[model samples]
Target chain A: MGISVLRVENLIKRYESGFALDIPHLEFQSGRIYGLVGPNGAGKTTLLNLLNLLEEPTEGEMFFEERRFTDLDPLDIRRKMTMVMENPFLFHTTVFKNITAGLKCRSVDKKMWPAMSKEALRTVGLKGFENRYAPALSRGETQRVAIARALVLKPEVLFLDEPFTNIRQRDIDLFEKLTKTINQEYQTTIIFTTHDLPQAHRLSDEVISLVDGRIIEGSIENLFEGTVEEIDGTQSVKISPKISVSVITEKRGKVNISIAPREIILSHGAIISSARNSFKGIIRKIQMEGQTVIVNISVDEEVEFTALITETSFKNMGLPIDSEIYLTFKSTSVTIF
Target chain B: MDYILEGLGNALKMIVSLDSEMAEIVFVSVKISTISIILATLAGVPLGFYVAIRDFWGKRAAITILNTLMALPTVVIGLLIYSFISRRGPLGVLGLLYTPWAMIIGQTILAFPIVAALSLSATQGIDKRVEKTALTLGANNLQTALFILMEGKFALFSAIIAGFGRVFAEVGVSMMLGGNIRGFTRNITTAIAFETGKGEFALGIALGMILLTVAFSINILFHYFQKKRM
Candidate 1:
């Protein structure tokens, strides 16, 4: 198996302006696209700069491919890793010169220039614009040129800072297609910072969400799908399924009644007092399946509850299209955070 | 005004005819300015590069000194050099005063600070990423510095032009150091001074016209390089 490609440990950076980044630990294995999702000023760019060694960290260690990377020469780090900044700077030269700047710096084989340029341009769909002036390119085209320059170096790892930011939504498809091709073809380990949640969901194999310079939710899929319930009367909230018995929020009187379609228990009468906040609502509608029943209740004209009960339960209650039934849930099942 | 017209006509006629006397003065001006610019660039460009790139102790003091030197009065410099090279001074053994060499030395000293200070600003003005990018590309420190200098070549040229323009138009240094020696040490500015003092208005105006042309050419060259960089 391949070695873990990049590892960061207890990275901390503080500015005199009172902003700080305190990431305890983060790692990325080879051959995966790790999406770094956070709000603006959430330290995403700061983390990228630290990883790229553009700025020195205030404290902590970092490693690349099992080698100790802290205190390494920044240029050496840059040789193997490339970052495409949100707003890229194009050199005052033709596209070809800017793309070839890195190769020339490293004194790579001069004979390979044509081939490398061709491949890099093709990778980013910029094949015909080789001689164009860098300053004259549109924002999207300039970004592609920047990508081509970074990719042409054939860096082992690539960090993109909001690569899709200024591109129009309609052109996102084309951009995504190019990204997929580059990832598949180069097998380059990729880490990118973006606030586009849907883009992260579609492009990343794993998403790490950051808040206030801390990792709040990490690696849990469908995390937002968990129901958010405001605790009765406090500044607290909890997430849980509807049928939980301990659904009591920290506050006194408010709790959300949630039930998974599969977890709901339905009855024709108010049968038990052990569960709190049971409500009587008519089945306003019934949708039958092979062995399941979907009962939609109009708790109010606006609020509703949907429960999936077995056909047996529905039959025994003689639950027809307009039958009244009771919905029950315990408070203990609530998840308080 | 009529003398000015006649001087302009003579200036055009001299340029058209490639007259040797006029040629000699123009040649001397270009020679002194070019040599001084080269010396200043060699001595000052790297100094500026170092000052801009490094964060050593006394850096602020050094920058402040350089900035102060940038505004140093040309006549003051001329007087200082004049004292050191005079007949009764320590260097009188050489008898080298009132020559092109003395003028060259004065002009070089006059221009060095301008080039060095401006070069420093140019280097300092480049994006920080450009430096980091060069280093990350596996370039050693010297190589990285050279790369940045190449990228900032236009700014460097501007610095050199500003230096030459300062030196070439300077009358104080040329007149004092070279003693306005006719046919040998007489540059455009010194010649203009000499002709005007001797009541040769036509000759002084002709020299002034030539000075303008020379200054114009330098400006055109500076802008061309700037445009290429952009």
Candidate 2:
């Protein structure tokens, strides 16, 4: 926890098709579970592969434990780090043999195999399946065995790619509990890729959101409820699901506008308002729908917008449909894209 | 038709009575085929392993050639060995023609391709995970190869049995190369050919019974291996 376990700077991976993965920067603190959230084709697997040293990054330096990962031997890197893909591959053997396969290769003490195997099985809640054939294990059990195979190594960093996609429906709770126990007990740094928002939120200390192979939002709590756009030669950001202001007049590089909707306080109609610009628009349609009254307005024959107001505000204005209204909003709320 | 019945009866009687001469021919056939198949397996199994796992230039061509050889006509191989062992042939000074050694050479060649090609298919047909998982589990090259080969024991066994079966039942190579001289190179297949052609149906049928029994035993062994594997 005290050291920066994984340090990735300016990572970019290029595919044969010329598509590139452009992750500006990423850092994973040691002994913490970091969730990588992205849609399909967002380079999540590519990023994981690079981290596992299964593939080389096109451009970027990756560091693990203050040592450059590219400098490590491939076998040494594999021995230290383990990855469990969505579909884990199991050998065609009895469960006992499959579990002991890795250890057998390294030639672990023969007496230790049983104790080690029993502990691993119990950790994954697969207690009574020691002698069963690996292929006959249930899908969840198979994954658990795969986990056991890696867990036998006791890897420093475990990278899981969509760890719970094919988990049995009934084992979801068991898996969550198992992960929490492993994280708490082993203090293992778990880096998992998942698309389930709630699962990520539940398991992750930090979530990185990727879109179109770029990090649009890298932090969990930094989401902005707005659609970004450029208008009039300047990048402007418009907050969505609300229409408070409309354009009034256009100048060379700037525009003047008035606020619509009585929701904005007009203190004397000339007093300074938090809203920098306001606009005037003719009310096009007004009706009561689903708990709120819908008010559609046309501003300057160019922009159309909608605003929600309280029923009390609607009655106090006593305004009829198709009437003109003034709207105002704060400049801070309108962030530049 | 009468001779066919007498031959069949004598064949059964010889097996039941365990005739010493008939047993001698059966023993020679088993020895030759077993030895030839073992040699073929030793030479061809590794070739199978290489063909299945390694990627290189001409690998496909090599495998194609081996596959083509699997169907090589037995008599053609007999003629080839005959030419090499005849007085005018290159190794004629050694005078190996009409000997059991000559038959062994011919039979080994005839079975080598079958063993190698089948073993290649068997090894190649193994689950891809078997190798990848072994590698990912920290196995070095030799360990991974050995691990995969161990998992494919049944297939390797089948390949060996197939080679043995092919060589044991084949007559063209043994007859042309061994000359079927009695009390020596005359094996079960060659003995059957000679006895039937000479109107000695009893011995011919006796040899046929022993050969069929050997084939049946190999089949049973294969079944046992398969069951044990499953």
Off by over 4 Å in 1: A70-74, A218-337, B1-9, B47-65, B87-96, B120-129, B132-140, B143-147, B222-230
Name the top lDDT candidate: 1
- In TM-score terms, candidate 2 sits at 0.73
Q: Which stretches of candidate 2 lie over 4 Å from their true place?
A: A2-29, A50-71, A208-337, B85-87, B93-96, B217-230
- Per-model TM-score versus the true fold: 0.76, 0.73
Q: Model 2, range A1-337, lDDT digits (tens) per residue? A: 4467777888889989877888777888767887888767767878887887767888988888767877866676666667777788777778888888888878889899988898888999999678999988888988888888877767777787888887876786787677777767777777888886457767888777665567653322212333334566444334334432322222323322222233443221344555565667677878664455557666675565555566776777765767778755554333221
DockQ of the candidate models in sequence: 0.28, 0.36
Q: Considering every candidate listed, which one attains the maximal DockQ?
A: 2
lDDT, candidate 1, A192-240, per-residue tens: 8888655776788778776557665432121222343454542322333
Worst 10 residues of 1 chain A by lDDT: A218-227
